[model samples]
Target: MAVFSLMLVVFSLTTGEFVVSGILPDLAAGLGVPLSAAGLLTTAYAAGMIVGGPVVTLLTARVSRKPLIIGLVATSVLANAASAIAPGYAVLLVSRMLAGLVVATFFAVAIATAASTARPGKQASTVGKVVLGLNLGIVLGAPLGTFVGQHLGWRATFWSVAAAAALALLTVLRFVPDRPSATTGPVAGELRVFADRRVQLAIALTAVGNTGVLTVFTYLAPLLTEVGGFPPGAVPVLLLGYGAGAVLGNAVGGRLADRALLPSLAGLLATLVVVLGLAWLGGGHPVATVVSTVLLGALAFAIVPGMQTRVITAAGAAPTLAVAVNASGYQLAAAFAGWLGGQVVDSGAGLRAIYPVAAALTVAGLGIALYSLRRDRRESSAQGSLPGGRSRTS
Candidate 1:
């Protein structure tokens, strides 16, 4: 039941964060804004996630984790309902931004909640279950929104999201136990964990890697409809294929990370460069575009679990705060990518241009990962040469 609660939170957050892609056109039509302007909705929402994560974490420092999570999930329901009934685009955008705030809090608390409840030695798997919800959201939620919007109008998609959030709220309330109060130290002390060099590197990689993914995804609709010449109705199918690949990549990445940490991280980033480059090159060919989309999803998301574990390991003392910051890093990357993608599109480079730009970012991230890997090896070699040659005697 506790795991189920975590999954529900994951599903709600995933759907709320991503449903925008499927309904972007409808939103533009209803809001009287150009698609480029309407893309601000995603950017605004991600910005909210970036700001809200730390604020919520700090404010709730003395609160029990379970009740706080339930409240956050309930807020998701209300925001979605507000979005569904919004009379104009401004209201809908604000509502979605609030929904983003709710998502940040829910995810941060869910990870904390999962860690608190996990059996010994199963922490990684517990974290994975929560993440599976996020991946499932990417895999399943957008398609659901697109289908509902196509048939019943865009408002119906929000209505369904509201309903799902309500269900998640109930599951969390019924199953997850009340958490103990968090550490009572000043929040600055909590934040000091991020000062570690390796922690900084891990967050940098997470930020850049996610930027690489969203730079392409933020423009996926335009590429499919305008560049690839796909019918509008086929959008969901392509996204679904991408989602399927994401799930596969996530599962495989998790296992690989468990077995070999830094190697897996470097390998995933290298794969992203190849996959993103292929997708960029294939943008003009329809069959090749579809193939690229699936590969794009796989290569991009494959880093999530591994990158997350890397941060937690590096920030050993304050894993909860570290994980929350990582979520913020992901949102920051998405917001930047969306803004950058929009600039490229509005500048006459066209939507396909975003892919090459994204590919370049992936390559840059791989370079950072390589530097961090070398640093790790050098430190290990230095440690091996320490006095007494690994003897325990003082």
Candidate 2:
């Protein structure tokens, strides 16, 4: 039931975050705003995630996880409703910002619920299910909302998202179990994961991986339409294919991580670099571009669950803060990638340039993955040297 509730929340949050992109043109026209101004719907959401994740995580650290999730979902539903009925563009922006903050809170609560809901070794699998919601949303929600917007208008998109959020709120209220109170500590305790080397590596890797993908995904529609010469209507199909691939990759990634963490992480990162680079240079051929795009989506998502597992394991007892921080890093990376890619587009480099930059960042991430593996090996070797040989490392 917790998993079911989380899946719904993930679907709603993911849809609400990226749905604006699909209907950007229509939204701009209906609101009588510039396309760039409408883009703030995404930017405001991203900005709110950056601020809300830590703030909410800390402020609600002492609160029960079940109640936190329920409240966040309810807040998200109201915000989406507000967005749907906003009297003007400015009010819509405010609505999105509110929604974004709630989404951030959801991220922390959802992961904690997923992790604690399970027994010790089952942590990764449980949390993976929760994170899977985000992947499903990224893969399904945005495009689905976009398609709905085409016929029903942009306001319908928010209405649908609000409905989803409301459903999630009810599910969480009915299903998720209440957690014990969090330990009382200064707020610094939540931020302490930053001091751990392996934890920092995991966060850095997540940021790098996210930056690589967003740099390309942020401009996907334009690339497919303008560069690949794909029909306008075909964009959603391509996006759906990408989402499907991410779902596949995420499942496979979890299995591999359970056996050997570093090997899984390295393979996914390496595959992403190759696939994204090919996507950069493959734009002239429509089939090849779509294949590479799906591969890019799959490979990037493949890293998410495994990397999250690595963060939790590395942080030991502080897994909650570690997971929350990882969520923040992921959003931060997307914002950075989108901004940097915008610079490339503004300079007349065209959408094709975005993937090549993405490819480069992915390659850099592969390097980070390698360093993390070597560190893991060293830590293992050190544990072997202990007299009792009980394996003190997490």
Q: Of the candidates shown, which would achieve the greatest lDDT relative to the real structure?
A: 2
Give the runs in model 1 whose Cα sits over 4 Å from its true position: 24-41, 85-93, 115-125, 149-155, 225-231, 345-352, 387-394
Q: How much is 338 displaced in model 2, in angstroms? A: 1.6
Candidate 2, superposed: residue stretches over 4 Å from native: 119-121, 346-350, 390-394
Q: Evaluate candidate 2 by giving its C-alpha RMSD to the native, one decimal.
A: 2.3
Q: What lDDT would candidate 2 get against the real structure? A: 0.82
Backbone clash tally (model 2) = 0
lDDT of each: 0.79, 0.82
Error of 2 at 38 (Å): 1.8
- What is the C-alpha lDDT profile of model 1 across 1-394, one tens digit per residue? 8878788778877887787877889889877899988788877778778878777777776677777787788888898899899998789889988988756666766776776677764555566677888888877876787789988998999999899888878887788888775657776687788779999998898888678788888788788888888999998789888888887777777677767777888988888877777777777799998998888777666777778777777777666666777899887787788789989989998887887788788888888788888998887777778885563333
lDDT by residue (tens digit), candidate 2, 1-394: 8787897899899999988988999999999999999988889998888888777777777766677777788889999999999989999999999998867667766776677777756665666788788887877787789889999999999999999889888888888888864546676686776798988998898888679788878788888899888999998788888888888887778777776787888888888877877887788898898898788778877787788888878877667667777788889888788789899989898788888888889888889989999988888888989988657754
State the lDDT at 248 in candidate 2: 81
